[model samples]
Target: MILEYSNGLHVGGDSVKAEEIPNSKDRKYYILARLVDGEHLSYQRLSNDYFISRSSIAHDVELIKALLAKDNVSLGFDNSGTFISGGEIVKQKVIKRIVTDLLRAADDRSSILKLFIDSSSITRVEEIFQKQVQSWQLEVPEYYIDDIVISTAIVVDRGLLGHHIADAKGNQLGSLLFQFDKYPLVYELIKGVEEAGVYSFTPDELRYLSYIVIGNGFKFFMKDLQIPASFKSKVKLLISTVSDGLNIDLTQDTRLHADLTVHLYQMFLRLQAGTTVINPLLDEIQENYPQLYGTVWYAFSDFGSDNHIAISDDEVGFLTIHFQAAVERTKSAKRVLFVCPNGIGTSSLVSAKIHRILPEVSLIEVVSQVDLVRQDLSDVALIISTVQLPAQTVPVANISPMITTHDMKTIMNRYIDVSMDGSEQEVDFSHIHSIPFLAKDHVLFCNAKSRTAIIDSLMAMNEWPNAEQRNMFRQTVFQRDTVQSTYLDNGFVISHGDPSLVSHSCIGVAILDKSIDWMSNRADVVALLMIKKEDRKSVEPFMNVIMNGINNKDWFISRMMEISEHD
Candidate 1:
């Protein structure tokens, strides 16, 4: 069952061979495990054990110390050397992190656990945990299941070592997470572990274990999930922060607010316990949705700092997925009004063609030319017509009566252009972001060596109401850059400050003589966007322009560079 849960977690790791000398990552995990397992380790002792020098071992220990400090866990020194000393809960957090790292590097989780825990103990715990989750018949996400398995094993390993929580009295309210009699999963698992001669858990320990389950995202399963009013407010603040930064009103997005409130609350529990669930699509999400990812990261940073909780990039990435969905939701579409002027037989043919080709159009209303004049077109997104319709307010796709192959392709392209799923839509390569951008006077070539120089050069070209406002805009740009570099994979950085700080909505472009290293990659061209609150187009379609422009680089760069000297 454990193997079933651990079948295919591919978190970018090479298979770690035991015969090979441990790499820095592997060595760090081993050393951290030893310290957490009550082994007093010193530089010289570690040096002798790994046949490495004392200096190297000291470097590793120093790095390990910094990592533990971030989690509020301390590396303590005594007459017996050095070991990690923190509350039992925090220690388990460290243990879970270590286990998570090891899991990333190996396919066989049980083999990895056997290094620190007895094989028999791991097997018994895996069986009990699997049985309980199965009994609940819950469809838990695989990434979540992986997280719980690590945490559950950690509880058994650490609890039996006599390092149990002294008193879970403070968490008495939280112990209600698992009503042992009603929800026998946690209760039965603990009992089974002790019966299998693994470890005897105290009442406090039992309560702590319930938290372990909850921390690993068991709260998502609780049918009577009650979110505190205070947490809901924080969730709203988070949404508002991102909304303010983007200049888009998401407050009215009741579904977004509801979904995000739940997600952040679960994330809050995970962060408070120093537990993190790996998001497998993190790389793809951050890459494809860089702006959304950066905005969410900045918002979450504030949310965590305000609430005194630490947020991980993984958590930020997860929340970004929710917001991305929310942003797409804002691109609301109405029913597609299919207009057919031909006979009923032809109208039926057109309807069948659309249903077969454009499966994305959920609702299709076929209207004759007579009905088109009288029908309320307010709710229609698109009009697929067999004949020309004059003075149409909605986008009209006038196609051949037969709806040829070319017609299907053209209509699909048009549908994609006006759709929310426009990221995958084809963009015209020759089309420059000239309209509304007003970059002719601002776009200029530069010999800048650094990103700051590029930003400074571009900033000087823009009109600011005052020095204070200029500094405020600059600060926001840098603040966003800190969260995630605006560097695109195509050697271009689309930099933008907060929209509200802009006195006049404008954009500036800089093409450098040489490519300098931007945070993620190298960049030669940088675009600074200063959008005022009223300018809802936060460099929209332009982002798509930059992304799709990657294939036609020479033409795109030459075109953008030429914009500098445009009249």
Candidate 2:
């Protein structure tokens, strides 16, 4: 074994020399860890253990004390020994810091398990947990089970080490656990730990274990936990804000409100405990559904400010799942276009009859056969035409010149259960380009070498009416990125600003000189599609066209190559 330093000083020996002792930072960390684990190490004791002088240990103690003081913790020495002093809240913060380092050190699943569980005892705990899960028939998401297992193992490990939580909060949690202690699955979990016989648990310790179970989305906790009304009210208010902002009605969904309220309640509890929740589906959700992620973030970004509890992206991702499910629950209005062959009178009559028959159908517009062929009916759900027309992608309802009851009934039956199945079709980008939002002038050929530089150059265009608008747009774009990356996998980023900041929506094309690690993805970012706020959802179809083009290898290469050459 050898000791080495950054300065290339190496001593080849079995034991480290006095001069090769650990640095101040390392010594402080060791002392802090010992104190966190409830070890009362006096200056004399530390000096004797580390083969260091009392003076050296005393200096290290002062350094550690200064560090602890910054976080409102204190180091004290008495006749008993040296100890770290702080309220439970501050102590929990320090514990969280230690746990974070340990988790980081455990780079693999096996290593993580070994950190808090005996290798021989792991199989026993696994079998007990698995059996209980099977017996309860609870559909716990697979990703969350790891949290439950790890948390339970830590409780058992700490109990054996005599690190028991006996605070008021712990007592309350324990009493709550006792309410359902008779439940078979809960009993099984407690019995498994008790049967190990290596450690004894206080009621408070048991409650701490139960808290872990609940925090990880256990069904047992939901049945027994009583959420405060105030928290519920805050969640409901947030839902309302989200509903209004997205223009999606969510209040009528009682189930959604209840579910969101409960989830937020548990999230707050976890935050207060300084515990981090991990979401396995975060990457997939962010990539595949960027719009949903953005909307959920917009809705909840203010939640922390109003509630005094910070919410992380992991928690936001979990909330996004709830909102996505809720959005699926709301019935979307069906858009229908009526095509009539004859004059306005006949089309009007047909429209009136169709509305009377199917009230759920929202008639988009009345178009003649010739007019309908020229119109972009991409948004149309169903087209009811009195005249025979050419074959098209959208489902058509062909009826007689005089709309009859049988024809109406036939049309209703054929498309009643119809839903937009997200089938891709050819899109025309002519109108999108024609929109005043983007033009040859709006397109910039920047020599910028980074994402931020390219974005700044694009927003600096005269297209932004004023400096205030430009700054506002800049903030909005970066804020969105902070929530989730706007960079797509196809080597292009589509960034946008708040709708209220812009007079009209347009896409800005920025051909970067090179892509320099935009959101940790490397590529020559060929273009940046900047969208204005109001046009976010409205321009999605156009985006779909762009994405489809990018996904097609030939189109992506030729188009981007053409733009690159021109620049």
Q: Estimate each model's TM-score.
A: 0.57, 0.46
Over 1-567, each residue of candidate 2 has an lDDT whose tens digit, in order, gives 001122222322245456645455466655565666555787777776566788988778766664443233566567857887754334544543344345545354333223233444445555677777778777776655665665555556555655556662543344555666444465556566677664466765565555656666645536655677887888888887667545687888899898888778777656544454666666666655555565565556556644555556667678878887888677556578888868889888888888888776665578777777687766677888877789977888889978777998967875674553422234554444343345556566556786677777766554667888778867876676554445444566666555567765666666555545554344454343455444444444434445554456356445444443443
lDDT of 2 at 324: 75
List lDDT for all candidates, in order: 0.67, 0.60
Provide the lowest-lDDT 10-residue window in model 1: 3-12
Q: Could you say which candidate leads in TM-score? A: 1
The C-alpha stretches of model 2 lying farther than 4 A from their native spots are 1-122, 158-188, 217-219, 222-228, 331-567
Clashes counted in candidate 1 amount to: 0
Model 1 TM-score is 0.57
The regions of model 1 sitting more than 4 angstroms off are: 1-25, 58-85, 106-113, 117-123, 161-163, 167-199, 216-221, 271-274, 334-360, 363-567
Give per-residue CA lDDT, model 1, range 1-567, as digits (tens): 122112222111344234544566556656775676667776776766666788888778766765564344567788778887766676777766655555565466554454455445546677766776788787667677766666666677666655676645354346565576755555665566677676777776766666556655545455565788987888887787778655678878888888887677776666544556666676677556755665665556556655656566667778888787777777656888888777789888888898888887778888888888898878887888878788888888889989899999878877876674424334454547464564677877778888788888888877889999999889877776654446544576777777677888777877778877565356787878777745643444455455445545676577776676676
How does residue 1 of candidate 2 score in lDDT? 8
User: For this target, which candidate reaches the highest lDDT against the unseen true structure?
Assistant: 1
Error of 2 at 45 (Å): 21
